[model samples]
Target: MPILPRVALLLAACLAPATLAAAPDRAPQDVSGRVLRATGTTTSGEGIPGIAVSNGIDIVRTDAQGRYRLAAGAGQTVFVVKPPGYRFAEAADGLPAFWRTVPADRTAGAMAIDFTLVAEDRPAVSAPEVLLFTDSQVKSARDIDYYRRDIVEPIIGRHPAALGVTLGDLVDDQVQLYAALNAVTVRLGVPWFHVPGNHDVDPGSTGDAASLATWGATYGPDTYAVEEGDAAFVFLDDVVVRPGGTGYVGGLREDQFRFLGNYLAQLPRERLLVLGMHIPVFDTGGRETFRGADRARLFALLKDRPKVLLLSGHSHVQQHYWHAAKDGWQGAAPLHEYNVGAACGAFWSGAPDAQGIPDATMADGTPNGYAVLSLRSGGGYALAYHPARLAAGTQAFTPAMALHAPRVLRRGAYPAWGVFANVFMGDAGTRVEYRVDGGDWLPMRRVERADPRLLVENVADDVATALRGFDRSPEAVPPTHLWRGALPTDLAVGEHRVEVRAFDRWQGEAVAATTYSLQEAGP
Candidate 1:
């Protein structure tokens, strides 16, 4: 539990804020905004009441006249919650614009921030699909070109999703590339939301407040919310910039908690709560990747909520984690968090395809790709991963999982060897089974071992004398999503089809296949 702040600080926070470290002693100014409904025919004015507005710490709903007033300190942002059934205008770079950053120089007068949304043709749908891209991590113009060709061109004009969001690391420490990235996204023609990753921070920043100046200028707000379909999506800037070139850590700021407290209080209990950020809340390897106290506080806030999903992306690999009693999550069921795979898997390293795009396979053998998050009618959701391109220039259908097995085995020999299946989106309890020659399915053991597929590439790179590509593929790491099944060599000498099937909780059954041959052993 957090203690109450001083009366003066309370007034400064306006929305009743709680902080682990108190903000500087500075008076806040009143910030007012009006939510207006605009159309192609009418321009005069139409107030839209009940629209949520915020000053980064406090949330306020528009009054009957669509007006709201909240307090904000210097360097804060004033933003409007984009609700369903409406559309916002595009920024100069073609990104959906929704927030205004308060000038750091302003100290005295009231600030006015207004937002206008155009009415849509249809009401909010029961289910909405979102395209999820993480850690694009583009560092230069060429990388951006690879991003467009490899990640964007395939989905262009297809409209595979109603909306899109980049979970973070939009660039690799090159803040200027944000514009170039959005320029490419403009072609997708969907309202895209962005979460700032640690790499998105400006290198010259003096502190956390100053770090995202470049990001805020282009992407709007460091933290904000959007209401779509049956879910409320809350985006947070959880990457805390350490002072004096100490790098960064995953943690929440006091003002974010304040905004969350105020906003969650007003949200309906029946709607799904989708929390998005750049860093995973779970501590990595007991090394405290995220502040444990902040995670506990966030879990406490969601303890009473029935439907919640945490989405984050930072590590190049993909994974799913759950919070239990040990992690201080008190919800009725364990909390589920999806640490999504990076779009620029392993920093876009690996051998290039015919298109000059790097294979970009993750060290764990997951392809460099994006995910589709299908928000269900009720509180349920479904998810699927789409690889940007096939591995090693293969033209086969996008595989659910990659298979690695020996092409031949000695008959009448011990079945010591096995097949390894790297389920790109698999988790701990995923049901994985394999069958031979369409025979009965047998459970495949989940094993934490390097995906042999990448190990082959690793071996290829190790012996190469020259540069393999833009960069060599990441060294293979034992991934949690791998499964293994022993190969039986006692079978008759012939080619046998081996099919592995796994049930993904999000997308249901997935089946992939390969083959092996057996030959009689010589005396």
Candidate 2:
């Protein structure tokens, strides 16, 4: 199958564990030559026809001889979208080198850009699973090791996803640490893509475009895309730098809009369009995180057909939003946006575990982790989130939600308390129900409150006389994915097992369990 089209942008965050190991060499640069051959594979390497190449704005296919001519403005990049059944060699540092920079000085008669690819042993995939990670934001070398051990290590011989993407804030203002982090991620084998975050912007940069110099040099084009059998994935650099490079806003630059307008027009409506970025398209902190007009413009450009899914990071907590007309989304159905959990949960805060890694749960109660995106043939999709560390080895993590409840309650007393089910992947329409001791299933009410489980840590931190951990657990914030159902007061006088279940649109039904007890009312 031929790899299809669309474009994308940047990668993940950071955390810390007990050990601090340095990462490998920096990623490889362009296809060897500064002076690239554009026409004669006989010399240009552009001789292969039907290959897709782009300048982040215009996309063109190679001529009969695999030769292509693309117009890339000064400072733009020329990269080839990895077609199915093919692979690029990893640079010295293990990062796949697939792009070349178009020099700032373009007045010369002709410019050279190199793109090289080799065949892979794997067969073409009709459908692919992609891992989506974000906000590693590690500040020190210790955080790098934490990210490596806590996240990457378990995933190394484990994940078989086609490729991976990091939504942004790969590090916390520590730009120099990018190489070390890349060394950690390269172990996954699949090519990883990244975009800049507010923390990723070069502080020394004079403006928005300049802020990404370090990022672009490390990860290629701030905005680009790739095609697969089931969808077209696009990455966009949406963080706009403020004047004097002091602050930033979440939005897309004009050049991206031009690129999107041109690229989307050519996209087949039958294919899914997955846009990956660091900052979310919605407002944050009571302010417009993204420019309203730009969002409106971007939305208007995306026609109703073909399923469109947006993946983002920046808010450490996990969430989902369906943009409607009021939000300037006038599509056939409300637009679905999944605000993914941070890889460096709560900036790697919380009490250290036995392994010396922080609890790192997001303030909204989601444990720091990453997402698995399953893109099926014919434009259908499904997704699941994996908390960094799971119970024991080999057994893949299950249980769509985690259950929490009282240990023992007075028998025959007012059932004031209830069980809380934090349905990790739940949404507004997701049906979550609970039952006790083989009784009837009762629907759990969706609650926008802190998860009672995490509250214990928050309260402990507030009342403690000394530091609880290297960093305190995140202060609990009301979460949109939590559910509650009061435990019956009249239940039998012994321990009772409670069961909870939820329906995931794609993965089918998922179940979980916990226990609570009832004691005699007497003191």
Candidate 3:
């Protein structure tokens, strides 16, 4: 028995070390992966060490090898917060692009989830619905308020998944207002993007790249691209301002051109191409100029593509232009260009509404409004124009007549009276003329009256006397004519045609000619 106890003690001593050693080797239920950025072409190259990673609860940074391992519960989601100067693709609903969770069963053993960080190139996808907004141009706090109340609020209410991109003129030369503008739009509850406009550029700024840097700091990248759905969206920095200048002229830098070429080379022609920017490649207004040689080069690169949609917004008007292959453009398919209007109608000018918003009209005469492009599920898309005012009804007009005659009229005499006609837009601005049976075409005076209901009223008593053929006697001949005008005394008793031609603004002219017989009475 004593020998057995000694053997048991020896066995326990042997097993104690093994049990302790096994405990440390046992892996925890939770494990983490590292998202390391590699330089050059080699995977074994230096790892850019400190990157942030989190499994919702535990936040950790990668080690020197760009490797990070964390103790996480099974089936937990792991996401990397994109560091500054880096951006992530946004989902259709504006959610941050993220990697989904791994199933609990898949993560049972020593699991590994790793991401390769690379320099971001323009996004290339299959088909994408691009959001375009032009000329927010919020001038003041009041204007910003109006924008929030009128524009931003309504758009956010829609909850669009497509990314929102503005075409510059974001603030009206008020760089200070950018923060407020951003703050208000951020309320959109989605990732919104912006492009630099002429107003956004500081003409006196030191370097050509300075403005772009400022813009990128506020909004990511002066020009960049991302893929959504099946399309690649290419945003260009087209707002080329002269040094010490504010107005927009067209031109692109050599580097941007090269970047575009490289981006296009990586994208397949079969995929949809969408170009969004502040300035247009082709000057539709005839006042602005094309974006110089670089633009032409970019155009040449895209000319042969099957499908390309170019969106611009500097003109502050709504215009749709399609160039066909027969038009001698380079592309195999025609180019569809849409110029979105300014959010501030006419720069927020004109009369003020009850809300103190102006009835602004853009320089191109288009009212303030926004455009919505929806990608259909079955490989197509639809476009809609949403105007600010909500009007739904039909308008019509009522008609009346007026006549005049002179007091001094004789029996068997016809009177000549000045006649006037009036019409409204609803009245159709009808063409109205009158003529005596044997008289020449007498043009009637057309006047604009303020009140539609009381359009025709008597002008003169002389017109009434002339039509009645009555003598101008105070007691013998009371004025029977509706208008005051003198009658012609040379007409013999006979039937005459009183022709009245009325033409509606929309439906041309019509004639209402009738013959009336007159009988002479002894005076």
TM-score of each prediction: 0.91, 0.89, 0.53
Q: For residues 30-68, what per-residue lDDT tens digits would candidate 3 score against the true structure?
A: 454555553333343444344444454434555545555
Better of 2 and 3 by lDDT: 2
Return the top candidate by TM-score.
1
Off by over 4 Å in 3: 1-130, 244-247, 284-288, 324-328, 363-365, 377-379, 391-523
Residue 243 lDDT (model 3): 60
lDDT of all predictions:
0.82, 0.77, 0.53
Who wins the lDDT comparison?
Answer: 1
How much is the lDDT of residue 346 in candidate 3?
Answer: 59
Error of 1 at 431 (Å): 0.9
Candidate 2 residue-wise lDDT, 68-89, digit = tens:
5555566778877665555555
Clashes of 2: 33
Error of 3 at 90 (Å): 9.3
Q: Candidates 1 and 3: which is better by lDDT?
A: 1
Put down candidate 1 lDDT per residue, 1-523, tens digits, no spaces: 1111132123334432222022223224677767788664353387766667777776766655666677776777788887766667666777776887788898786677788876665545667788899999999999999899988988888864667899999999998788788889889988899999999999877678789878877887888898776778999999999888688889999989998998887777887899999999988866989988899899989999999999999988888888889989999999999888898999999998887889899989899999888888777888788878765543112457888999999987899999998888898889999999988999999998899989999999999999989799999998889999999887889998888898988778988888899998677
Better of 1 and 3 by TM-score: 1
